[model samples]
Target chain A: EYPHVLLAHGGGGRLMHQLIDAIASTFASAELARRHDGAALRIGDMRLAFTTDAFVVQPLFFPGGDIGKLAVCGTVNDLAMCGARPLYLSVSFILEEGLSMETLGRVVASMQAAAHEAGVEIVTGDTKVVDRGKGDGIFISTAGIGVIEHDRPIGPEAVRPGDAVLLSGDIGRHGIAIMAVREGLAFETEITSDCAPLAAPVLKLLEAGVAVHCLRDLTRGGLAAALVEIAQTAGLHIQLDEAAIPVRPEVQSACELLGIDPLYVANEGRFVAFVPEAEAERALSILQTEPVSADARVIGHVTADGPAGLVTLRTAIGTTRVLDLLSGEQLPRIC
Target chain B: EYPHVLLAHGGGGRLMHQLIDAIASTFASAELARRHDGAALRIGDMRLAFTTDAFVVQPLFFPGGDIGKLAVCGTVNDLAMCGARPLYLSVSFILEEGLSMETLGRVVASMQAAAHEAGVEIVTGDTKVVDRGKGDGIFISTAGIGVIEHDRPIGPEAVRPGDAVLLSGDIGRHGIAIMAVREGLAFETEITSDCAPLAAPVLKLLEAGVAVHCLRDLTRGGLAAALVEIAQTAGLHIQLDEAAIPVRPEVQSACELLGIDPLYVANEGRFVAFVPEAEAERALSILQTEPVSADARVIGHVTADGPAGLVTLRTAIGTTRVLDLLSGEQLPRIC
Candidate 1:
């Protein structure tokens, strides 16, 4: 552990994992022990998923989404990953003094629009302001409550060997989008973030009876981090086909130009689902019907042949390499 | 209405009220329209209360409580105000890069202790780190969900004429304690913050069949703001006896020295309960049984006469004066 908190501690990588583990160990509870994107608890006869996320993305706004939209969508997606229908959200803001009211209005409006799109209501909230330099422009923390309609316990524990791994869409765009704007990188075709709510598609899959064993959204640490976490938690091995994973050309180029791996780049709207191999085609088709996941495809499958808690990636050049968690963040504050 | 967001907008005074109203109008929902400290929600046959609060109190460590304890107790108290037994909380942290790891550990330990004392589980959480100088040492945002066992429909709308207003304990200690530490004020006897979880006392009142009509914690804008907001919402006038309201001598002296009103000072643990006039003594006794509310007393009563949405205070010298919300915050970031 580092003696002082560093930006990497929140990068959703290995450092972030260590930090969360330390915190989780201190606040150990049955629900928190699950270590999923959200905590699923049974309240009487109803099962609810509760989750929280704090957005400290710099610039506040990027090409496709602003901090407001990201805040809402991020929490909603966490609930969605738990196979829950997000119903209500509590939004809290820590605003810096001297921030433009116009900017605040725009962010609030963006939040409203995002909430409406995600079919979730912003029910409760709190606002606190800090001195000008003590805070960035704004930081939005959102907590979401959602209802799990199905009986399937969707999490890493439910993951089984031979389960098909499906990627919802292209990755790396969101990170590239944020990095391009933050680093003043100009590209012929601007790469907008693929930041969209995933509840609709997830609900359709569940409603259509897709036996989703596990679901994880690719966020701060992108596809690699999500896969590594699931593998470690499930005590299983996952094999990924790099050729099958979708990545936009512009985003790939952006990653290459910045000496970053596309697999390590973040994605706000992308998620991977694990289902029985027999149901992979049906799940893919159901996901493809939704515009957000139109690029959905089967990327790989779980296997028991390797050591547990290992993830291997088959490169495009017919080489297999172990995919490991990055120690630090390639781009900080790219939320 | 200001072009830029001033600290007053988050001060929990008139400006904060206006800012909240504007934001609320944009994110209008049935739960939000109620405007209670927490939103009471119905999920299937179960009724739940959900609320969020962000703690940006400077000088993270105060005389009696730290920001970590304050964060947990604040959200728990909000749910208590909704007449709910807080069950779970989601803790999110926005950390500034380069903050000492020891400080983070101490804060987390405090949060765990506070959560344990409040009888709530920290189920889920998120952490984000910003660059040094971009944020204060740390800002904690907590969202809590609690179960509402009773069907009393407690809120301002449930208040009736001739309702007795009860104060749990001394006011102004929390705010003054923070101010003393932040401003380096030397008081002979230190004023420790009255920051503790109020759920136990409130639950006791409800269980004892006190016919509680409304409950509200005195936080940022303190007793004055809570009373005014409740009065305006219930469309009734309230009259308070100044001599009956409890205020510690040290707290009063500090407020006087700082030229701040005790009525407008924040208290983290204290709350006001509105019950039927006939049950005033019973409710006070029930509250006093608990150590947190040992100083419970009748401070005022709701009246239908005179003007609606007015709060009048009767001084010890037989003079009545109107208590209104402060236009700006006397102390910002005091929460």
Candidate 2:
């Protein structure tokens, strides 16, 4: 009866239910049609893991990925990094009116590809079309659930004072690539965004029986922010040798010229693993053995002292400086 | 060391993990910090129900709610409508470079209040700041994990032909309220958005032994869309007496003036309950007995053959016509 949607649809009224029944049940299975927040899934003896994320990245489409890929990857990896095997994802779209169906199609296709690549399923979704100018072209919210082994316990709190930090490949490449494209910076070599599925590699590591204190994918705020968080959480001071941190020449040059620090730059397709001192070398060996992780190295060590556990970088000249959580945007950095 | 976030933070990268951990560990407990996706919590023997949603509503601040309230309630309702008792929520925020901290504080406070009102706790979160011009003010994403009764099997498929459709109350107030304010439409009586949490009322009906076939919140597309969806999903026809559909007088007038149908308007605080005809009066009584559901009524009945699952509305003239989902945004009609 509505010629235009009244505010009541969002009011959780009869209309909202109808819209959900039509859109969600049309594609989802009878199970999803039950209209529960999550489908009650039974997966072997493994522990069930769940996650959700919202995508509001403007310009929806960037060089390497768009909101679609980010939505899928963000949820899938959230599960995967937590020692879970991703199984399904539920996607919801808030589309502004007048958006081209073609764009939506492409975005959905990209999501499909990301899900397929991660060996997950997009089982349910909702589409809400807003008035033109009422919203941007699109906003996506994705929720993911997975199955994890009960034996695998991964997180920052697991890190001991003597644990060594192992990095998967180089840092700042993804951050710099985005910056280059976003800021229109010139580079001697063109850098590409490092956006990819890490479920496979992470699964491989889990299978190897390596004891990992934590496994976190460094995406935003880079390695520096991650280290600081881990240090503060675990109550241990983290010291990293600047020279030990790996950064590609192109990324480094861009950072130097832009007056941005590579440590705080964002990176996709990379991860940080905190391992015990005794197991650090083995972890590095296992990581470097994989082609996806060619530049793996032990970049820092956790200590028990200094300001109740902070992350600091030791310069080549032997001076130390605090590495703090960035409170602002690292614009001109997302190439 | 994130100098600026690239698309990779949304990627499953080092940046993404740090970004998540930075916020997660900031206020999380030791146990929660260890869980990959906002604490794989164990509360007694109840299996968990997980849900995720992203809020991209235009005008982050609206009549009765803001993006923050919607973010919290959207996920909370998703869990509640599933008949789950919501426990914890995970929040993610994507902020534009220039967004003031004051606005963010207001949003956070609103979310905190909503969470408190729903009796759920905010456990973990993620934050990312995009460059200026690349984003609007702010976008918030929330994911919730709740617990539901093991035997609460609710869904469209559970619906049978002879079921009664019970609406919690009213229609189209939310959409119209947003529209009116956005368009500067003057009215004798100002309409506010109906964005209240429905968990309490739903729990009340369940407690009264309503034995509902399914329960769904009518959002986005309003009553027409919600009913049509239910009809199609349950594979049954629906017949509604237009006069029985309860719309506020002002809302009805507004719909008529705007060439809009209240049935197609969106509602945020209402829901549809498909129950056995025997339980119809009881459900209505139980609903109407509550302060939140005082307007609960039986607007329609599920049928077997005629129209084969189409929704037909009987008008005041004693004639019936099909009701369809609203195609897109009717922006001018919001409150």
Candidate 3:
């Protein structure tokens, strides 16, 4: 057992998963047990999705988005991943005593704009200030509630054999962008974070009656962690074509230079959707209608002819390698 | 406008109110404009109440309660003040790196026990860890969703002239208890925080058909801040009998020693119910049924004769004084 919480415990890898499991086991609710991006609930004939996230990014402001924008979009995308139309959000801010009002105003303004873009209302909130040294500039915790319009159960539990895994867009830009700014690395081309709301495209896919089995966002541990988690939870094997996964040239170069794998880097606005092979083309078309998912591609498929919970990737060089969760975090506080 | 956010901005006084107003104006939602403890929402034939709070109590653990218990009880009570039955909660944690796993385990256990006592389920959660010096040991933010069963329009706006204000139990213990622990003050009798879930007593009042106009919990800035905010929101006058306001001898002594007024000190398990003068006795009896509020008493009444947005208190020496929100915080991180 771990004696203390290391930075890796919140790094969105194996350690983070273990920490989450330990805390979740104590509560022991069925909704929590499902372990989806959010908890789906039924209250008086209404189906709602509830989720919460804490954003503790170090720099506060990054290449493409600030912490406020990231906070709103992160929770909104989690609800959207549950195939729910995002509705209301509650934001609670823990600010350090010495934070400038101008900085706070800028963050609040960014949040308002992001909420407007996502069509969600900021309904209620709270604020607490810690002493100057006790807290960073600001840490925002947002909990969102959304309504699920479709009747399908959307989560890892619904994944089945012979399902296609479609990625929404390119990966690794978000983590690289933050790292570049933090480390003062001047890349030939600026790598901006791909942080945007995915609710519109997700809702569009649902409106077109796409048979979506599951959806998972590539957040902290990126594409690999999401796939590994889904494979384990569904007790299925996943096969991926490495060439089909999109990583921007700048991001790929930065990863190579820093000895980081693009597959395990974090993304703010990318997700993978599981659907039947027959509906893959239609789902991709629908997702492409939105700018956020214009680069959507089918990267993998689920299968039952292998060991359960195994994920194998076929490299461009025609070599197969198993993908597993990293014991330590590649990046800390990317979100 | 302030140049930087001060500790007083989160002290639940005038500065806090101003900061909240500024943020709320940017969101511009009617539910948020009400400035209630929680926002009451209507979703598909369901009347829901949503609220969020962040707990940054120093020392982690204090007499009679800890941050974990406070986090659960605070959100639950916010929902209860909305006249709703809290059904589900979303908890998010921000941990500082290097915190002992044992401390986290203890906090999680306390949260579970408190949730069980409050009859609410922790349906969803998230966690993030900051560098050791960037954050306090732990900060917990909880957002609760509760269902309102009654149809009465309850809030400061519903408060009317001739309404009676009934307080639940004594005040000043919670803030004093934390101060005692932090300052290493040893009193003749230990002063423990009155931090407890108030949903049971609140639900009892509603179930008993009490004509409750409004409910306000005595939290951060204590009774004075709650009264002033209510008076200003209702645009009415409130008169209180200071002698009738219960303050235990130990808490009173501690407050005096610290040069703090008991009326401005915070309480965790206390609240005030605004009802018609005719139903005051019945409401008191109903509140007394629950052990959390056994010391319920009628302490004040609403009036229209004085200046609008005014709160007056009658002292034991037959002198009247006006209660106003403090310009600065008396105690930072008391809750």
C-alpha TM-score for every candidate: 0.99, 0.78, 0.99
lDDT by residue (tens digit), candidate 1, B1-335:
59988999999789999989989999989888888999999999999999999999889999999999999999999999999999999999999999999999999999999999999999999999999999989999999999999998999999999999999998999999999988899999999999999999999999988899999999989999999999999999999999999888999899989999999999999999999999999898889899999999999999988589999999999999999999879899997
**What is candidate 1's CA lDDT for residue B323?**
92
Query: Quality of candidate 1's docking, in CAPRI categories?
Result: high
- Rate residue B107 of model 3 by lDDT: 94
**DockQ for every prediction shown:** 0.91, 0.06, 0.90
Q: What lDDT is reached at residue B218 by model 3?
A: 96
Tens digits of lDDT, candidate 3, B1-335: 79999999999899999999999999888999999999998888889999999999988999999999999999999999999999999999999999999999999999999999999999999999998899999999999999999898889999999999999999999999999998999999999999999999899989999989999899999999999999999999999999999999998888889999999999999999999999999998888889999999999999989888999999999999999999878889987
Q: What overall lDDT goes with each candidate model?
A: 0.94, 0.67, 0.94
Q: Is candidate 2 or candidate 3 better by TM-score?
A: 3
What is the TM-score of candidate 2? 0.78
When candidate 3 is compared with the true two-chain complex, its DockQ is: 0.90
Tens digits of per-residue lDDT, candidate 1, A1-335, equal 49999999989889998999999999999888889999999988899999999998877999999999999999999999999999999999998999999999999999999999999999999999888899988999999999999999999999999999999998999999999998899999989999899999999999999899999999988899999999999999999999999888888888889999999899999999999999999999999999999999999999988779999999999999998899988989987
The Cα error of candidate 2 at residue B140, in Å, is: 3.2
Specify the highest-DockQ model's number: 1
Model 2, B1-335: lDDT tens per residue? 54432333322223334444443332233422322112222333445555565565667787788878887887777676666667666666656556665676677778878888888766444444444554556666677776665465666667888898898888888877777767677778888778877778777777766787777777656777667766776778999988887888888888888887777777777788888999999888888877768898998898886778699999989998998654343442221
